[model samples]
Target: MLYFLPEPPEYAPPPRAVRVPAKLSVRVFPEVIAMSHPYELAPTRPLSFERERGITEVRFQGGLAHVEVRLPGRDVEAERLVLLQAVAEAGLPVLLIKLHPGSVSFALPDAAIAERAERLLLGRGYIYAMERDLALISICAGAMRDLSGVMAGLYDTMDKAGIRVAQTGDSHDALFALISGTNAEHSARLLRQTFGLPEGGTSC
Candidate 1:
């Protein structure tokens, strides 16, 4: 699907990207190019390894869950505050959140918290859904949103590898994808291979 950077006054410039050829690239990320246009994935930043782990260690964090809600309100910020308050009261750790027109999808630390969330949020002018056994994967880079084909390639990689994504969110700084906890390792391996990064850090 058609998915959605800056700065010239750099302290240090970003590394040149490795280009995926259109022919081989399209086979890998066919969903990226819908129209007859051309784009390039800018160079990746050569990571500074003071204590950097590189792309190895396909790590997956467990004990995560998500909650989706639809409430009628124009003030997104106000709604967010309300949701955060409710989640906090439930003793669940809120991870990432995405807001649509009147709908919001957010994640918590554990599935058991759903009981508190539903009890607290339901009948309070909101329809909500809660899910558990989820893992979050996020990639952050400078100006990733502005880079064309990057997201499409990501989705394509998941699709080919048979990774089922539970939810996705994006901001100016990062891209987040939630997948089955069981599939986290496979998905992480696919992500590492997709980016041509070195493997073997700690876990997968």
Candidate 2:
């Protein structure tokens, strides 16, 4: 049996400066046990498991599979094979476990990185909402003269709202982390009001 240790009191580690390769351990649920167990279990040599946020992520030296599991009632075998091929190609350890609905949430240690991630998600059709600690703004290229235009736009928005921006800059394809535990709708409304965006305009 595995045991989780108590968290350190009043201690929060700073985010990693550089990206490091790590394995992601996905939980497989009991209902799907029958479906998953039938496949031959392979032990990936040198596969190392790390516990992060209550999940065991399996990491390997190099080359691992990119596994995908579909939603329930969808084709399971097809999805399993997709996952298998990804793992086999990558040469990483495989972990299959079951999980309850709404049990997973992506987390980033760095605030700036989180912001960039939100932007990527926004580009991929994930709607941007508001964040209490961080405000999301939208700037169009054609409306601006140059990089300064973008900064000026940001300043203008902040100045109009009577909100002071302590630190701001270009994330360079990174995700921004606003306030933790904020809802989608509230996040969206905040962005709209702050940036003077019209209805249905995208936010990042």
Candidate 3:
């Protein structure tokens, strides 16, 4: 006789029930978050031409010299580099550098530095021009690039006042014009009046 064995039925586990909270509470600390990540808040009101836009101040900086180096040959780039390297080696600080096809121009802070730069150029045999007794008129504002017609207005004002601008430069917040030192005070005053700034603003 043969014994018959039958396999038992497969066991099945019951499904698990998940528990979820009916109400969830979240706490936020603004001061702690701000302390962790510091940043400046933007102005609530949009920038306006009447209030927030336009020139904020007028500054006059005198006793600067404008120098232009002319490199007329085909190796203008190399000559320009050599000239700039010489200036750097002399421990001279140049500002408002502008490059041309065969020339480079910049401003020296004072007459003493200008003289030193002139000596360096003369020693190197570079053809250059140096204009002394120049002043930089800075039209200071917030976000100057965003303001339309600022440059035009400034040029118009200067032209009307018979102030001759030798060179010009700009930053994000200010527009600069190099003018005669003799006219710096007059230019500053006229710019202040045109831009509606106070008469007692800072000038040096």
Candidate 4:
């Protein structure tokens, strides 16, 4: 059995950075399982499993943008209010969001929404930072939750391919990874292969 050691939140390691490689290692697992099982119950060498493929799309949401809202005095309630207000101003939904010390980062559909969000929040005495040219890549495989290793292997494939993931979200039926427009085509191609999908699956 594998054992793990815990680390303090302050000292927790940052997420791994993936790089582009000429080829991905087909061997996802580095070590073999050492188990005392009956021969009849043992698994096959090259295991074959089933997976559901989601309708994957790499949408360019009208010039991607991210706005960072500073949390005044660590007042979490105030932060929530600011976010809700921004959403109302955008007239569109947020693509993704992340929180950091004294601030929260949001991925919006376009520069227009980001600009509007910033102006609205600024009027309320909030400080923020903004960025653009981002995108949303969602893998909508309904079989994601039902199967183990589907998501893991997906990430592994991406990591091996050197795809840069900015923000991400997932549900039982889907997975999402945020990236820049420059990486969209490559990311789409790799994801297509990762899911074992035909060309038709990569459309819209």
Candidate 5:
């Protein structure tokens, strides 16, 4: 059976904090931010490395532990070797499943170890991007008398488009990702139609 940790003891403080407010203002602001899509892990894939001049970059994929590294010059290889040795000495056991110019990645059997390794590498200034793909739409309009009505109208519009929604968050913002790029237009169309919004409603 698979094992799980309820909460991994905070390896480090969270990057940011959440704010709570008691009262709301009428002044409205329109802003949009992309919502990340959920992605499944492909752990068996091996890591790869690239180098140009004195710069090196490494790429590896796994659970939440996607990794990428950049180093200056041909010294990248040597630097990676030393870094791995140091981690091992710190009592952090990781298997060097792959090593290439500019980077190396470990295949850890435990999620806790993998997460710690990821944070350590990131804290060292290694460049990495999470594997999340999402499309988020935000709308701002004069305050509606009922928020529930706003949501109903939006969902009905999406429903007509024959799009299957995985999840809908409780916010004026709409977050949904298409299965394919070809469906994006359809999804956007559905979204606009639902909200009675005009094309190019949002500024670029």
Candidate 6:
């Protein structure tokens, strides 16, 4: 978690020079002033459409698979640890890990790793499900941590566009969602338009 203190209503004036006693025979100087407060010094101007929307870019990554492992017993923590260790031992790199009441889910970079992970789980008698041909769409912003309604707006746009999101994640600067690989390009285009981003703003 992070906390942002409000900027002071007014900038503090620079310090004045102070006099030293003759007995000390020392000259005292105020510390050099640092940069001014951004809130006070920044220029005031109308924000561009994209800047106002806060979204800076849209990114896509294709050829990923989503997997979920079900922990059926009472010790879900132990089960989760063992499952993760098994994946690590198999040398499968996972992303966007999420925990549910009885299951843990993550994304694999490619189908080969997904298949290998599934085989490992099956051999270890762990129940799981895997979905292939998924693409990750990232909505990047300058201040996502402070933005409101961005996620809701994103989901609403996707719902209207008939894009079904399989998994989601977020960070201080971006939001991520996994959708069908077939919809990757279209989803990126739609999001760019919806957020008022310039054409060709997406990168893979």
Candidate 4 has its poorest 10 consecutive residues by lDDT at 53-62
Q: Per-residue CA lDDT of candidate 6, range 61-112, in tens? A: 8999998888977898988898899889888999999999899999998888
Off by over 4 Å in 2: 1-132, 136-148, 171-197
lDDT of each: 0.69, 0.36, 0.86, 0.67, 0.46, 0.85
Candidate 3 lDDT over 98-188, as tens digits, reads: 9888899999999999999999988888889899999998998877888887788889999998888889999988999999999999998
| Candidate 4 lDDT by residue in tens digits, 18-99 | 8889888763453456558643233437754855454444333337777777777667877777667756665756756676
Q: Compared with the true structure, what per-residue lDDT tens digits does model 5 show for residues 84-130?
A: 77677657764323455665544443457666766776777765432
> What's the TM-score of every candidate structure?
0.56, 0.22, 0.73, 0.60, 0.29, 0.71
lDDT at residue 183 of model 4 (Cα atoms) = 74
* Model 6 / residue 140 / CA error / Å: 0.8
Task: Choose 3 or 4, whichever is better by lDDT.
Answer: 3
lDDT at position 46, candidate 3: 45
Pairs of colliding residues, candidate 3:
none
- Candidate 2 worst ten-residue window by lDDT: 54-63
Cα deviation of 19 in candidate 6 (Å)?
24
Q: Residue 81 deviation, candidate 4, in Å?
A: 2.9
Name the Cα RMSD for model 5: 30.7
Question: Candidate 1 — which residues are off by over 4 angstroms?
Answer: 1-58, 73-81, 88-91, 123-125, 140-150, 170-174, 202-204
Model 5 compared with the native: what TM-score? 0.29
Candidate 6: pairs in clash? none
lDDT of 2 by residue, 1-204 (tens): 999999879977897799766987875433432344677444444544632221111111111111122323355555444434543454433222222241212223334544554554444443233222333222333222222434554455446645554223234321122222222234334444544555464222
Rank candidates by TM-score, best first: 3, 6, 4, 1, 5, 2
Clashes of each: 2, 28, 0, 4, 3, 0
Highest TM-score model number: 3
Give the Cα error of residue 31 in candidate 1, in Å: 54
Report the lDDT of model 1 for residue 168. Answer: 78
Q: lDDT of model 4 at residue 36? A: 80
